[model samples]
Target chain A: MSATIHRLDNRPQPSLEPMVQLVAQDMNLVNAVILDRMQSEIPLIPELAGHLIAGGGKRMRPMLTLASAKLLGYPGNRHHRLAAAVEFIHTATLLHDDVVDGSDLRRGKRTANLIWGNPASVLVGDFLFSRSFELMVEDGSLKVLKILSSASAIIAEGEVNQLTAARRLDIGEQRYLDIIGAKTAALFAAACRIAAVVAERPEAEEAALDAYGRNLGIAFQLVDDAIDYVSDADTMGKDAGDDFREGKMTLPVILAFARGSEEDRRFWQAAIHGHRTSDADFAQAVSLIRGARAVEDTLARARHYGQRAIDALGLFAGGKAKDAMIEAVEFAIGRAY
Target chain B: MSATIHRLDNRPQPSLEPMVQLVAQDMNLVNAVILDRMQSEIPLIPELAGHLIAGGGKRMRPMLTLASAKLLGYPGNRHHRLAAAVEFIHTATLLHDDVVDGSDLRRGKRTANLIWGNPASVLVGDFLFSRSFELMVEDGSLKVLKILSSASAIIAEGEVNQLTAARRLDIGEQRYLDIIGAKTAALFAAACRIAAVVAERPEAEEAALDAYGRNLGIAFQLVDDAIDYVSDADTMGKDAGDDFREGKMTLPVILAFARGSEEDRRFWQAAIHGHRTSDADFAQAVSLIRGARAVEDTLARARHYGQRAIDALGLFAGGKAKDAMIEAVEFAIGRAY
Candidate 1:
């Protein structure tokens, strides 16, 4: 059977508002640091960076860092900077991804590449990436630096692997999973693990939090990929079918392509390889994906990962932080619902 | 008054061979480490990275790191990785720069962007950048991370500033210096300073080496800028008058525009702003720049910086590293002669 759907009249299921509320104070500090670090004498650096940084998102990754630090009863302000660094890394990747994907919109607004052009976007993204490292250095923890830096390397590898695999319909589910793991989950894992490192928590605690974030990240991306087929620009904060147009090999596409008939396979190949996608083509692709139960399968996979994310937190004592973390996973999977 | 101009019959002056010889063994280890760290499961990463890594520019930046470490009498292998990290940062910037500049050629060959396309180049550049940080993390020194990371950020700022200043004829000498200082010298300064830190030397020694590298870097870039106007693609390893065609505000152009006749100023404005340039126009521009003695004046400024670089070495004890470093400075200026 398909996983339990948690839609409340097809609206965004119980939002990430609670988790965000729990970390609001720490997030304010993180936001302040982000703004301060983004400042530059070059107006374009700040102007282009501010365009993306100020755009609205859940700030989920940084929140995970702050909440994880709080869960372990940390007694310092170091996590604030680490959280900010996490946010900067995320923002930097988003900026560069827009350029890589040739995207025109992000967070329901014009992409930075669209506004400032690719050169500025690329350079500003570099600035943000470097600034993130500076934040990690200011915290003066080599362990934190190791985790974050390795994650950054893995993220780039994942992005490259994805680029290499794009439009290649032969890629299996495992490779797709690997792509998302490196591209999305690695950062999340590092962000949470760093929280434990800064708090001087034991190895087991660090591993647990890392596992939580990693699974959560995978689930988040699975749902995200699923939503790309089902949601619109308003709900997803970007044009729906962007992945299809870009020929990204997400879960639903992989599943649909695998399960398709000969004629259906030809359609995917024509649209993906030949770049012959149009409005009618996207509609037909979506119908084929739904007929293959690909969206349902993708959500099932997301729920499986989301359950693991919650289970990873079982060792932690139950509290607002723990409870909110679990709820955040639910919120993530609920997006697919 | 114009300082020594050791042209050696219009050839590149005394090469950086001595410095490379001094750090030969250490560079071997650095090369090994760079090759090791550049490896990834994704074959494209190593392929593209290896293409540039093996493309045979003198490993001058990494050599500086190794030489600095040796000069300070350090007795450790940590600098091997740090040097590799330095080179990765430099290479990553070059890869990204090629994309940003839409360059077709580098070091007498087609650029990676030309071969792999912009998307792969951008992502691979990111992979290399992240790999550099991973190397720094492996070095396990927060101070080294701080210095290198800050340099990276400043370099991005410098690059963005240069992009902004491109084609702006009114930009003065100080801003031009600021651009090169950030873009070039900052990394050189950091690469040298890290040696002192790793050696646990006093702050004075660190500051001295930093000053030395910074000045050398500025001089090297100034000479490079001047060479772009006077040298051919064969000598410079890239196209001549590239900066002029791209409207980059190098010192020779800045000096020429500042000192030009009214009609000459308008010519520069039309060529730079209006993009009204041709082969004949380039010949005319060269004559105008030479008539203004801007290339000579630019060489004069490079000599000034080279002198400061040599002066910064006075406090250090006499050794092969020091001698090679001085010779390297002479070689940098010699390029312009």
Candidate 2:
């Protein structure tokens, strides 16, 4: 492998800027489509949607679509629209998640719900979702529609599963993986696999890209869960220990609950299940989590997934597009530090 | 035409039982598909969805699909699945609408939100919507996908438009129609048109069914608005004066505001716009609506649309299916009484 090719052992994490720049031209088109589709005569629809869409994120999902298409040597513009649809699905989930989570801040800014209220947030989220389907239909590919639509259903089911499992101390590691896999990885898998379908690539290549994106997504969310326990508000883009406060059963918490002593487990039950918590409780919980080595173990799991993600790209040849994708996987896991 | 055939001039409104009887077997298939699709490993999904689906509002939109197909002499089984999909979309919208409207009761039963809470309601609504799209994909026609997806977007836009227009007395009759056309009529139109599409009928036939459904939906909504003004809590299946309490500018209030005296308009401004109201205020508002002939005028308008709906069915031959459809339109308008 060349110096630029990202490997599993690489300690220095690559910056997301290069991966973003790799598909900067396609990203611009995706942005345009997002803006165009989000417009509505109902001003609230555009106002609420634009607030989040225009708020800066890495646009990582769409970038995956664009990069996967580029790696396959597909020279078509339809992926631009599909990428936009992918982003819409992501944004719609975020909007609804904020409501479901009762979250006030996202990306260090007041959430749309805090500004526009939950009803508007929910309705606008529905509008954006519907708009995503419109874009997909305009693309006129049943295969593409099936993939994205099924991904949407899986995401909702994941969210529902998470809701049902909330605050349950017995939520196992495998169930946690299933939740994030459906909630996060399914969209990523669809976004990447769609590029292959649109390029008229074979099913084998599509399956490979799907595997890559799915593993990368699990790694990304694993790191995010880890960061919630360790990072400051500024680094994590929201309040630290939010998962604990909200009583979420993320992987780290699951590990901590599994490994902790009876007394420590009692503390978790009172804090999370009872929801009678304080800053000191949070501090103690964090101490217990780190003491139990849960955070370290979570990151280790993320690294494993990240490695698997890079391995999933074995079918693609060594090139700039492939390197950036592999490097993007590194960056996803690297978010832990 | 036989006496059984419903004509526009007919004064006696036909019952919906015959229409239900006509599509009885097909509706059973649709219901089975609904129950099948609603199943999930997560127990909460089926529990909540089943509660509402079995709560029993007439499956009017899906019936339009089945009836339209039958009228065209199309004996395919695809319409049953499509009909189920249509009902899912409608049920999904109701689930979301209950959340958006903060409704406590629907169809004489506690709403899903009241039983499960807003988060569950919103997420399950999303699941149903995604399932609807999946059904469309299984139908394997890009044209059907395009029509249904576009209608989904329009329905959402109409809802947002209604949200924006809520409590704004200045919203005119045309804007009101536009809102309902999108929120209500668009789905009906798509449902009816898809029947023709699945049957491989010509474009003209599709357009005719679309028109029939669009007009019928408008008339149905108009009667609903009128019912909101005149009915008791038991009759309306919700609290009487709910629209007034929510400050909704439905047709009766709109017409009343247009024709009422200056002092009467001021009462509306305080009660609806200013949100300063009481039982006495609602009672007075109802008296004023009756005196202004708004209820009468609204029912007249519904009748006009009902006539147009029957007219749109003129392209169909005289038959039980066509007669049932025409009667369905009359039943829609007759609800105002």
The top-ranked prediction according to DockQ is 1
User: Per-residue CA lDDT of candidate 2, range B60-155, in tens?
Assistant: 999889888889989789998889889989998999899889999898889999999999999998999999999999989889988998898899
Restricted to chain B, the TM-score per model reads: 0.95, 0.96
State the displacement of the C-alpha of residue A249, model 2, in Å, after optimal TM-score superposition: 0.6
- Give candidate 2 regions above 4 Å deviation: A1-6, B1-9, B274-277
Native contacts retained by model 2, as a fraction? 0.63
- Would candidate 2 be rated incorrect, acceptable, medium or high by CAPRI criteria? medium
The DockQ figures for the candidates are 0.84, 0.78
Candidate 2 lDDT by residue in tens digits, A1-337: 4543446648575677767888999999999999999999888998999899998877889999999999999998999999999999999999999998999999988999999888888888888898999899999999999999999999999999999888888889999999999999999999999999999999999999999999999999999999988987898789988888889999888989899999988888987775656878888888999999999999999989999889888888878898888888878877777
Per-residue C-alpha lDDT of model 1 across residues A105-133, encoded as one tens digit per residue: 88899998898889988999999999999
Question: What range of 10 consecutive residues in model 1 chain A has the weakest lDDT sum?
Answer: A3-12
A323 Cα displacement, candidate 2 (Å): 0.9
Q: Which ten residues in a row have the lowest lDDT in candidate 2 chain A?
A: A1-10
lDDT per residue for candidate 1 within B1-337, as digits (tens), equals: 5544322223346678889899999988999999999999999999999999999898878888888887888999889999999999999999999999989888988999999988888899899999999888887888899999999999999999998998898899999999999999999998898889989999999999999899989999999999988888898889987888888889998888999999999999988874756888888889999999999999899888988988887778777888788888888888766
